[model samples]
Target: MSSSLSTVLLIARREYLERVRTKGFLIATLLIPAVMGALTWGSATLASRAKTTSHVAVVASDTVFAHDLKQQLGSSAQDAMQVDLVEPTTASRARLDEQLQDKHSTLAGYLWVTSPATAGALPHFTYKARSAGDISTKTALEDAISAVLLRERLSERGLSHAEIDQLTEKVTVDTSASGNTKAAFIAAYTMFFLMYMVIMLYAMNTARSIIEEKTSRVFEVMLATIKPEQMLAGKILGVGGVGLTQVGIWMGAAYAYSTFGIMASGGHVLIGLTQVLYFIAYFLFAFFLYSSIAAALGAMTNSEQELQQLNMFLVMPLAFCMVMVFAIIREPNSRLAEIVSLIPFCSPLLMNFRLSLTQVPAWQVGLSFVLMTLTIAVILWISARIYRVGILMYGKKPSLPEILRWLKYS
Candidate 1:
């Protein structure tokens, strides 16, 4: 490489090592994964609990209905739930309501079955819970009640208990996707989210670092050795290296988990060698695209607060990508997905989403990378022009017209 390029890389290395050694960087790098892992583990544990200690009351006009509801509720809860069957008298209903309103109420919730006016009409359910946020508990109650009603209906039709059970048996939904759908979904969703977060994270970090140097007058000294474009390149590359390092650590952790059998069988299907390669390619182009814009904006700003006011321009695209996530997952090969995958701002995530959820054609994948790279190049040129003039600027932030004039002058 040329000495100039080597100098740029040297600056990049210095920036990378400097940030990587900081207490804030170390804490964030380690904390993000640790928190994510804890949340994942906690969610799984809560979902897998065999029995919940909920105290639920079931009330119905018919003793049989109340008893059946109670039985179903007990069976469905992961924990040994305390379910009480009560006759639906006005006094009994009022008593339950009072208990629920009590400050020291031990009752979790109550399921009230409104008896149909006629045998032809179906019953209505009114569930009151102390906490409305327990979706799993509510889902379990709904499923249990539905199961009980189905059994009752079948029994009324003269079907035996065996017949009811056999008819109600759950069916497995197999997919043609290369791996287990759950594992694939988890992997795909995680990768897309990580890509978006990493892009925004490093881009913002570049902006903050640039503003820091600009405010502290360090750029005055650095400019003597390097051009504004080189400084921008070095900062982008240096900060980009930190992001890559974090991703590498996470990837290594995933590999270790898979190797030790911590993950389920076919976990490798989610992150094959092909996916990793695509990831690296997309990450590099995405980084350059956003980081270039951040560097230019940072060059113009004198304070971090000033930079924040201009974040909407950068944030909108990321938000748009998030909104497109469901569509890409649902129909990876749809016309909309294909069109979106070619869009420079959305392609990195949408294209990766397609690759993770479904098999994207090699041609489409290559086209996405090509389109994004071209877009990145264009952005870098525009940002470089802006940076060339903007770096020496200080005090008041420039307006849109002033920035446009700077672009022309540069």
Candidate 2:
């Protein structure tokens, strides 16, 4: 191997080892996944527990409707809602009001049902609750009331119980897809989000490392020993390696959990093997492209704060691509998706979205890869040119015109 290439590799190893050994890195590496798992489990547990029954009292001027409402509320049995009928007397009203106000009361709510003396009049129903904002309970009550009213109407029209039962019976349609729709969406969203996170994080790490070394005057000593190009190459390699390590950890954990039955059918929801391979390929190309840009921006700025101002330029494209993802999700095979997936800056992420939602022609995928690779190569050359000059000359950050001149002269 050439001495320059060997120097780059050695520096890369140093960078990787230095970062991997940090306490913050280790804690974050383990803690984030744990937190994510906890949140998922907690949410599911809460949803299941939320189905516990509520106690509600029913007051009615019409005893027949009151009895039917009680039966209707308990018909499902699954919800476990308890309903008791009370006459609409003053004592009953006062007692219920007191119970609602009492913090220790077990009553979830109360319903009031009344009918007019006029013939063929419909009953008026009102619900008052201790927790007035509980929309789910309110919705359930509304549906139950509707079902009871429908039954009464059907009976008045001379429909028999057997006919009414057949009419009201539920029928569910079970549809099958070639691939799981929900699984595809979840896998795509997770992978796309992870890709964005990895690229932005490591690329910024490259820029920050450059700024820190430049500020500390370590770049001077390093430059004397090795060329700027080698240093830049090493930084990208080392940080990119770290990102790959994090991804591998996550994927391995997922596989182990899936294998051991820790995850309940959720492992099957992830994208397939071909998409996984595409993800890795896109990640590498995307990382190199962004890191090179970040390196160049870092070279032009003396401090992290200045680098941030220039960082906005890099952020816009990624943000645009993220927004475009929603559109792509809505219409994965649309012309817009296809065009955006071919655009070099947006291809890495947008193409992944396309691949996840629907199958793309092999040629389009191949073309996207080609375009991204070429874009990375071109950007790497330009960034190296800027790094050769920008690191040595530092004062006020250069203006746009000055930066353009640096690109020309360098």
What's every prediction's RMSD, in angstroms?
A: 4.0, 2.7
For model 1, the stretches where C-alpha displacement exceeds 4 angstroms are 50-53, 57-71, 76-80, 84-142, 175-187, 254-277, 395-410
- The candidate that wins on lDDT is 2
**Candidate 2 Cα misplacement greater than 4 A, ranges:** 46-52, 116-121, 175-187, 254-268, 271-276, 408-410
Clashing pairs in 2: none
* Least accurate 10 contiguous residues by lDDT in model 1: 261-270
TM-score for each model: 0.80, 0.90
Global local distance difference test of model 2: 0.81
How does residue 370 of candidate 2 score in lDDT? Answer: 90
Report lDDT per candidate.
0.80, 0.81
What does candidate 1's lDDT look like per residue over 1-410, in tens digits?
48879888988999999988999877867786676566555655765674666888888777887787677766653436689887778999899989989989788788888988888588888998878897656877877777888899899999999998899887767553466677678878888988888889888888899888987888889899888878888888899998888777766555444345444344444466567667777887888898988988888888888888998778999899898888878888999899988898888788887887877888998888888888889889989888888878987888889888988974
